[model samples]
Target chain A: SVFNVPFTEKSSPGSTPALSDSSLQSDDEEFESVDALEIYDLISSISDPEHPLTLGQLAVVNLEDIQLDDSGNPNEIAEVIIKITPTITHCSLATLIGLGIRVRLERCLPPRYRIIIKVKEKTHQSENQVNKQLNDKERVSAACENDQLLKVISQMLSSCK
Target chain B: MSLSLVHTFTGHTDKCWATSIHSKLPLLATVSGDRTCRVYNLETKRLIVVLDDDSHSKTLSSVEWKPTGEFPSLAIGSFDSTISIWGNEEAVLEDEDNWTLMAIIEGHENEIKGVSWSHDGVYLASCSRDKSIWIWEADDNNEEFECVFVVQEHSQDVKHVTWHQHENVLASSSYDDTVKLFKQDDYDEDDWVNVADLTGHEGTVWSSDFEKKGERVTRLSSSSDDGTIRIWKILHAADDQPSIDSKLPSTIKTDTNQDMWELETILPIIHHGPIYSVAWGENGYIASVGSDGRIVVYKELNSKEWQIIISQPHSHGVYEINNIKWHGDRLITAGDDGLVKLWELAL
Candidate 1:
């Protein structure tokens, strides 16, 4: 069961987290570096897997929780780490929600970005387990290949800008 | 040991997922996100034909060749939740449209990850993200497949399904971080039951394969996301005197009977990331591919230890290899680079 509790009122998808479309740039053009705010926009509009609300509206994905390290190093691997908080500690849909956010970022970000998603510390009852399951690359890839789970994730991403 | 690139089969515009080598012929079939299965002849080192259809709307995940056919028959699993069986019974000599769809098996609620045919090609087993493994009974006519059993034992999404090379045992790896083996129950013989649960891997088990035929009992090789390869050996009471081997842990036992399978050894870790596929070649070698874009081959030093004979980094360039197969003495690999490569191993 989903606990059915709304944490906050709805938020708009038009936050200032969006960056330009990188595909249009030619080889000579400089690459636009990604920031935490832009990463937030990619997932803020994602619909919650449990409730009929955007993650932004529910305050599940805050801009402060998103961390990006795309500093100007051509050889260095960039990183994006996001921490999400469940409405309740015992929520059963925590892992599914985490997976949804990871999928959205994977589709939008460049391959150079290493994504690390986890439940906020001390929020979930089984915080360590949830964090471990969310960040495992093998399990993440296999979960994305699942048909039923993909459908649910697609629904969550449909509202994204 | 040394390795040399022997052949490269190219044409896929998108990532290729898996490849299947013909049992009797020198033909290789590869499935790709381009929605086509390309068959390449090893002798000519060229693609023979591309089997594509407008009916397929999603990427094909896995492919397998039926063992006994004079003309090759392929079983392809797709992301669109359908398994299409294609046969070349009436194929001409190098025609573009040589293969035709024979049957479409649909029942899984979601995408099919892996598919396998029994050693004799009598049974077809498929695992899906829906967390179910369905066993279908197939015949030689390339028609009507009946679903015999469906079981949901894995707690999470299933990754790969494989059959024993010499027996009827079916093994599946999953996102649940464990490998479960299934076999027909003796009381019914028609119903499939979970016989054993291999519980030691701390992360997801990506792929598993059986040694062609062991000296005493069949051994299984399982590769995992934890970046390690484990070998499982079946400890039969009849094979060893005094009920069991003194070295094996007494806790090993399948759910049904005294047939216990224990983790025999963990191969040397050469992969820094998740291992996607593992294939036990008939040449007494075990080959593995992983996310780090490395292909490592291992040989048994004894039952308790294995040595890395060949560790070739960047076998598929910068792309992760999805599947690996052994064609006699050579190795075939499909990768995210939209290429299928053949390599010769120097033993």
Candidate 2:
């Protein structure tokens, strides 16, 4: 079950919490607030490259794993941190999956929002390497430039609704 | 054995959203994020007119030419929640400055995403971010338009609306990850109802176009955010069967009572990114463009399967292609690079 966490309540860093009912209700007036559920809804449907199921269905992205830091001022920049769990301990496509999630959120979310995508610690053997690649701006841009890799990444995201 | 770039029309200062070519005239109309619509002469490759004014305060998303009207006209959809119709004055003697604003249709609450004229040019369909598709009918005598129907079945943003080549049938693709078919009611002149909801795409459907084989709309092609292009065939039920006659035009309505459309083929992983546009060319070809900046053309081989005939990677040099149109035997494409490129099939 997805953990129901309130947006107003502060949780420990890197904690995963399912969005609460209040957060979901605030989505209707999305222009004023950036909720944690909105970020979950964006990346949860992304299809795993090896499986037909989504990242959310495979338990790669849980509601409790999404954290949002919205400055009190709506005009200020907001931060969304998503800690993903690989389907397997040594899943090779974790970085691609993270890139797919990053691309989707970048296209859909407002520019004022900053995104941080990383693999959960101790979830995979190459957690540090994958996290560094995903968060590295130059590495992400270079990876996106590779035609063959982009094709595979696009296929992984094709299942997103 | 490769398609060659024939010409490139560079004028738009912002990302070009859509392109529409005139059926008879050597003209093309393009709309852009710069809040302007440009008309170009294909033969001379010159900008004939620029339809930019303070009236359009937001980006223009789509443009379509009236196929069978008395005078040449263009329908433009903008982000300002309005659709504007421009008509060329027949009585005017000048070549330039003849286009005038015929009407401003304001029904959509949000940005208008697409606008298309029926093959007969008697009706126009517009879809919007408001999750509604509005059908407008023109009154020939008064030159005014009336809203015939408003379809709110799509649960999310409606991205594109297209009409069949030979019938009054309309197809709409939406962010709801579904494509819907709407046909006019036989008994009620003003009524249009949804007949089918195609829901195979796992992502938002970006665009859809019907294939005109001879005089029939035998197939439909849809491009989606899933980076795939799908083909669906229309099937008519047997006369003896009890069919769901949701609504079909009277011209093709037989005793069968029902018509259904089934997914025929899936061109999976055709692009490296989300496909934004797809068009069925008159020369028995299909072209698709996507976020990967590639324009790929396909042709059916032996009526069984489709094969990629031309694959132009980096057609816009890393710029996402938003729309494409078939002008005569040539193809015109617009993209985020603010340039329009034309390609011709290699004979």
Candidate 3:
């Protein structure tokens, strides 16, 4: 079971609280200002590592559940579930794709969010583990606001530009 | 959202092996195992011309653009032991209706595997299974062409040849597991000579290319049957001419057997497939396809390490990838599977 917690009331950085419905609706309007659909569209801008098309166009990113926290009546946490596919089932580029997704998600999502990446339709060995590593790193880094990811992304964009 | 398949060209009965897109023009040229070369117009989705005959005895192996020009030209080589040049003369005509056959190059005794046109489109270099490479220059009349020189150095069949993107140099790879560089110098009678012979691959070197990444520096990429792709950095000679052998008598006017060029190797082995095709990509990345049907993306890391940025496998083994044509941000690849695929890497 998932619940949306309102961000209106500030808690200590390290504290974890239970999720409820009545409290989340109060702060929901401000958070909904940035629609969940809009966030999904933003993440879809991520491209395929080998092809010249977006992950959305290639149908590589599949979004399933959009869960929220309700403890604060309106300030709820957004939990998005996603699945990824490579150009080929046995592609060694799965890691790169996962990293690319993680990077793009961090760039588009709000602060202190949890994004779950589930691997589907991959029969190749170790694909799930590699995808998990990529998402886990991003989730932890985003929660901690790791400076390395910022530096890496900035450098990459500068070079590509 | 749903992705729809665009128009499919069904003219080639056999597998398509090579494709070259005129960067500044809307023309696309394809060579196929059917032993024919066809030119197509992208805007009209129509077949413009077909150039094939008894001369192309076997499969057409490669095709390349003659740089960029208003009346652009094309060069095609085939396994039938011939290289043919095709172009249009619209610049000098009122009605520029069709592409015409410009010249037929018949010199290589064995299968002519690849052809490359110099930067100015004034010269062409062709390599073949006959273990020789030939250099041809456009005639002063501009309507005809002739063989000016030949380099017979590779011990095995020469598989691919590519002109330096920004210089008067050519690079060739062979079945002997080596890559050789050729350049024309004015000092000695023989204008063409071998400069570098890069040796490292344990299997056949199937394809090679020279891409410019920085000022006067080129990245040399080679795909081999040994299941690996390799990269090398070449520092062009400052004089802009190959070093002529002082030992060779200056009086000798035309000795085609002269060996006078020099080459140095940089970087290390990078891919894990029998690389069949390699092309330059935006932002210093080099894209390569191998026999494993995998498109391996590689980027240079401080001149020593080349990171495998991506390894995308096609559904089947890709026997030959003759060309990788870049159309703006998109890259189109044609393989042995008879399918042309487009790819873009996510940042």
Top-DockQ structure, candidate number? 1
Q: What pairs collide in candidate 1?
A: A17-A38
CAPRI classification of candidate 3: incorrect
lDDT of 1 by residue, A1-161 (tens): 11011101111111111222333222103334677887888889999887889998998889999988776453334667899988889988889989988877765654335678888889999997898788765456557655678788778878987
Q: Model 3: runs farther than 4 Å from truth?
A: A1-161, B1-10, B42-46, B53-55, B68-70, B91-97, B140-142, B188-190, B214-217, B235-273, B315-322
Put down candidate 2 lDDT per residue, B1-347, tens digits, no spaces. Answer: 47689988877766688999888877889888667898888888888788986667677888998987667888999877899998887733236678888889999988788999888888999998789999999765216989989999999879899999888889999878899988887788788878777889977798998986767567889998778999988775232233444366556555343457788887635686578899998787888997767788888875558888788776765356888887666788997656788998785
Superposition TM-score, candidate 3 onto the true structure = 0.58
1 against 2, candidate with superior DockQ:
1
Where is model 2 more than 4 Å wrong at Cα?
A1-161, B91-94, B237-258
Which docking band does candidate 1 fall into? incorrect
State which candidate, 1 or 3, has the greater DockQ. 1
Error of 2 at B14 (Å): 0.7
DockQ of all models, two decimals each: 0.08, 0.03, 0.01
The order of the candidates by TM-score, greatest first, is 1, 2, 3
Worst 10 residues of 3 chain B by lDDT: B1-10
RMSD of 3: 19.8
